[model samples]
Target: MDRDSTLRVEKTTSLKAVVKKTYVLDTNVLLHDPTAVAAFKQHHVVIPMTVLEELDHIKDRRDKTVSREARIAIQMIDKVVDNASPQDIQAGVPVPGSTPEDVPRGTLAIYPDQRLIGDADVPYLDGTQDQANDNRIINVALSLQAENPAEFVCLVTKDINMRIKAKGSGLIHVEDYRRDRVLDDIDLLARGYEHVEGDFWSMISEVDTLREGNCTLHRIPRKSLPQAYPNMFVHDDQEFIAFVQRVDRDFVYLRCDSRDSLMHKRFWGLSPRNLEQAMAMSLLDNDSVDMTVMTGPAGSGKTLLALAYGLHAILEQNKYSKLIVARSTPPIAEDIGFLPGTEEEKMAPWLAAFDDNLEVLHGTDESCHGSITYVKERANIQFKSLNFMRGRSFNNAYIVIDEAQGLTQFQLKSVISRVGADSKIVVLGNLAQIDNKYISPLTSGLTYLVEKSKAYPHAGIMHVNGIVRSRLAAFAEENL
Candidate 1:
């Protein structure tokens, strides 16, 4: 942020027209969203030198996912502040706004938090131990707040504890970085179905019925299902279900479905155990839908449904040449190179759920092991770690990404973009089972996908909430 550049940006910017707030970001927020430095739009964005040191250390970590994000954040910061001198960097650097069409309003600066002096006016946390990095970053925000009493100085992070500490330390404005959040409440997320109190037709006063090939289509006024989107399902208590084929400004076109038809649908040797599974299976079987996002609680049978559909598509329908199963291994599991056969062999432990599903599908066979082995070979099933899935395209393949609640939006996008023509992807996640510390049910990539892709013509979404694993499993899911 050279003096001339800073003055030029300040003079030209319009959105800075609003009350400008200075935001000091934590290291976790950068790892969560690599482009967060520019997210402030017209406000001033500050990065503590301690955060840069943290990124420098984490960029070489064993966890490829976090390390990759750290590298990206460092690169973005470098791109913004490269032209500025060290002294200029401490002041600020000119960074681009959302688009070049909009005059850039934000200037990113690196604060030398370590060189803090004992200012009696500002309250600073001891940085010697106990989350030293977090304390230092909070100190920067405190320093900024004390220096600019008129302006709003805020600290943004994903860590709940850090936010608490900042607020306890007398910072008036502390916030979670919500630039990536798609919803305010996780429960407000799309469930792909609307369960009307009674029969669906009871409330519809006006409707125009038509036929499209073998499917019956009904055009209802948009006001009937005001919040409807494409691929959404509407069900009645009396057993009627309709798939929302498409939506427009004036109308919602629905394809009528019957409970008997959906329940009768089979994948491999498995039939729908419940309506939720049936709805999910319906999405999986739709050839026009290129992607499906399935989410539920544990023991809801998401993995089983995806695997069964993949096998049925490959073996019976000949929909694709192979079935590829992949998921993000725990960060520690990335060290499988220390004890592995092949990538597939190394990913076996993480992907054991798919095998368990296979056993359920072929448990009646005379030799269950033999049946599983034969199915794996015959279907060309491959187990892959999410780490190695980038830079590759799978054409004419069926892909299932399980346990996706742990992924960030950017990480999921990188994997989803690898889909080639003639390929379909089914993303499976149990939001309640999310393991990533930085992710939550509301911020999970699976949640983002469900919200963003619900209206996409070629994508489908479903929530299979039924716990069909066992009575004890259902009890635990509800009570424990």
Candidate 2:
């Protein structure tokens, strides 16, 4: 067939196809992932000039973390824009699915397209109101959507309210799950059941026959199962017991020995009470798991155990480069700036609890200020602000997110996405003491991380119970 004949054949052929258009990105999104700007191949990725301005402002901050972020953003733009032929910022960066011929370019659109859906109401220069940053991002998405009503205009943001606002404003929206990638509970069922010896129907009733160790065998009729895991097997030995699940009529659940399992062993100083430690270890033991959230009463050793595990990853296993310890700055009436000194000095109050844990781990010997410090000077320890985690890559690191219940979903995304190769993060907090009114224990970032990361191959979760700090402290935790 000739060229014309081939063209005619192609035109005559029938196939279902979908074409994607432009995607509007938020500044926070770019800060969260420097590579995100170039992520959309063959599709126009829009970065509003305002977003750039915000990047510039944040880039100039004094904080090392924010300043570093600015440097990265500047470098990315410089590399993309300066090296491109005629300065094609978008096209120079590789979009995953695009061919060489179909790469995107950073095209300039000075004015809003009046023909688009919501152009007439493009409320520009309206910064006096609340959530102005959010408003601009939404307006940009709305404007883009208005211009090409037929195309998909998604607002990609880490902000929960912004996501809700985008969805509420008749725009398609999604949070970036790239950072703290979550695994579903249903998918993790197969993994949770490491091994099973045939249809152990004979062993199901012999609950007392089971031993106390890593595997606990228990059988629950389909009715008594928790909504999360149905068809559970309840097994116990003379010493302990646990739950195993069955699905597809196969003996899919593996009863774990509760006592000697890696999850059951407690740290010398930070070992928690029964239920919390069990849950934490269950979540931790699974490399299939990605995120585990631990929340409970005070004196339950939540932070201590999390620190202990992180310390273990560093000192014993050498699985990560260093222990990265961080926490959300309390979002209460207190502000870091309001405190009476330098940033580190201002951070002292928030960091004292962490420091106290360190002291307990390795109390002052006049050699080092903290166990982490002692380890860092002797080995390698990384202590940073939650904000400092942005724009950097972490490989082989154990991240401990202390006071996690104070975090918003957006803040959580910022922290979680920084996980690099062979890294696991644990979030520890007590929801009852939450100071952020906008978030509850159930909706905190840590809770979201737990809910979302339940099924990943590398994540685990445990809720610390019982007070290990003191008898009175334990009493306060239980009774107060």
Candidate 3:
């Protein structure tokens, strides 16, 4: 071979060695996580022009959560291409990073198609019309796959249908962005309680007990402890229950006055009907536990228990000045059009659960009706929209977020960030009842929070098992 041809062959070999897989991102992936752009690591990222158009449509939406995410994705792309000439953008731009080492090694580019790549026409799919945004995005992936036959190309999206359609189109590489998912197996997640074995009471009886107000603290050998969090429940077959106050290399400290005491303690005229509920009550009543996540099946009394504890903290214990209740307003069957009112007024429909629980707490008698009104007036309770909670801080308040399964990890972080000094936040959700299309039981904000915050000193997580609402509800939960 000629010397020049040998050099050309070496250059081509080097190029092939350094070639990285290109990931074409869908709009849903960006909306689900704004930081997904940075999550690709060293791989090339392609933003389809169709995705940008969809982002443009979503950027102006009234729903700040998704709208803001869309804007962030747009801004990130803009910033990357800010100083680059049109020609440079046509090739690719490097993603910005705080440090050179932090920067993604692969290039980022925008794919704008003047025409479809091949003779293959877009296929008709149910629930999606021809020439749909998802179809166009899939075509971009297909085009990339065709152009770079040697390098791998994948379509990343949160939408399951998009993944299915991409696979149907013969694009084998399709994946759900899983950076925010904490656990793949739902059963492996924390259940908030553990069964003790072998002379648990005698083990505790040997420890030094210190009584401080209503809570008694004891320290036992760390080896004797079960896997537990700060406010986790430790119980044996003898009906002995204790709260994990703290743990160290040598010993475990537990806070408890008497066995089964929390179950008997009444809050807002309600007592815990199950052992899990009792554990939840103990964590809720403890002011030291600033963050709590409760997960269970429907009719497990998760919300009712959390609300009762919030009221008790606000009205009775004076630990917090106000009780603020919020819930994700995900559409159940269909969205009821735009609401007309202030934030709290707009949230009234979504907060019907709060009112129903309050009514139950106050009773339905004639005299009780008057008392309910009086309590409502004096409770200093407020309803908040999660969208409006961004950039605001809450101090000396008990914040309860219901229907947390509908929230993404980013949404949960935004809500938790608003918790200021001397404030506590309780997250309640049924993982099986997740309503959000973009999230799953494993990827929901509640699951992420519980999994990540389990090690935090002031955070407690509990998964209530037994359904206490009714026998029928329990049967339905089991069978259905």
Candidate 4:
């Protein structure tokens, strides 16, 4: 019954360093995320000599994005080891961020693989072999493991082959850099819609119905659909469909609609071929929504949907002054000035999909080519690269960012911020078609944006589930 008997507590005044493990980072890890050094959190991070040399070479790459990321990684390292002596750098320097207890969390070190000495007691990979830099990095991890036998040593890389090779070389701990990984399974990625079995209304035992001008609103208890977020769609097998208009702490407000209304919505003379496209078209036409992100497999008509909406908004509705279509192009391809007339002309090669869609729109005209040309001029369409999109604002424009899967969060954020006054941006990507070497569906910027913006009222997300391109194209998307 005594106060001391209920709970016993003891306090001790003791402090110990948190650097119990050493992590040798690969060049790709740094390129993937420039700020990866600080992610180790309370552990020792090592930048191998070979990795630094790789970064130095890549800093001047023709690819601006890669070069910028490499430069940022180098600058981050420099900022950490600014005034520290060579010995201190080789040993360990305290990282910038501190713990809540006002203690330095971790330390970063530069492991000079070139100065490594071979010992018969240690197992080291051949440094002069093919993949010499990779071998050197693995050797640094091996050397650390051998020298500090009591401490844990790990080789962190974004390269699957490097991980396999490191494990084959007798390194016990090797892992991928997962600081940017938002989901463990790609299946769990937000589809921007929820499918309810039977009738959606059957689950809601009680609801408050109200009217907002020309629209009908239903306020359902948050528990009925706890997973609901703004702009999400709830559909039932009985043809019931409603768009989530907004969400509050206690209830969800849904703007009721029918499948027929969404399907009948026309965009630049293009009608929805499926229910998913219908939802996407509706979202694009909503003036209240500033951004719409669409993700699905190839041949799902994401490009066509975005293009049709841009044309409708610019040419028909007079919603914006210009229609800007942009996408992330390959680095060598991005050197577009070498080949062409104007920036848009240079970009024509990469943005040919929009032209294809335009052709689809004007194919029935007497002179298809003339019709396309007239549409381009009438709509004031412009093609721009994501690289130069920085330091500029696009006002009163409808922007379409295509092939967004290959972008990182930073790249996507910069492009999204370029959307100025009265501008609406639609980001299109196929997660399965991500071609970037360092990104996967779970870490892709498209996935990042979809997950991060679900709670925002002005943002909408849609994943066109069906492949409506053609029978062969759909076959390839499903089976190949």
TM per candidate: 0.94, 0.53, 0.86, 0.93
Q: Rank the candidates by TM-score, best first.
A: 1, 4, 3, 2
lDDT of 4 by residue, 78-151 (tens): 99999999999999998887234465578899987888766788788878747568889999999989888888
Candidate 3, lDDT over the whole model:
0.80
Ranking by lDDT: 1, 4, 3, 2
The residue pairs found clashing in candidate 3 are none
Off by over 4 Å in 2: 1-14, 39-42, 70-146, 154-272, 278-300, 307-325, 328-347, 354-401, 404-460, 465-480
Better of 2 and 4 by TM-score: 4
The clash count of every prediction, one per candidate, is 2, 44, 0, 0
- Comparing 3 with 4 on lDDT, the higher-scoring candidate is 4
TM-score of 4: 0.93
Q: Cα lDDT of model 4 overall?
A: 0.89
Candidate 4 Cα errors over 4 Å, as ranges = 1-19, 98-103, 129-131, 211-214
lDDT of 1 by residue, 55-117 (tens): 999999887788999999999999999889998898877777643656656889999887886
In model 3, which runs have C-alpha deviations exceeding 4 angstroms?
1-19, 98-104, 115-117, 120-130, 197-226, 249-252, 255-257, 331-342, 364-366
Clashing pairs in 1: 1-92, 1-93
State how far residue 279 of model 4 sits from its true place (Å). 0.6
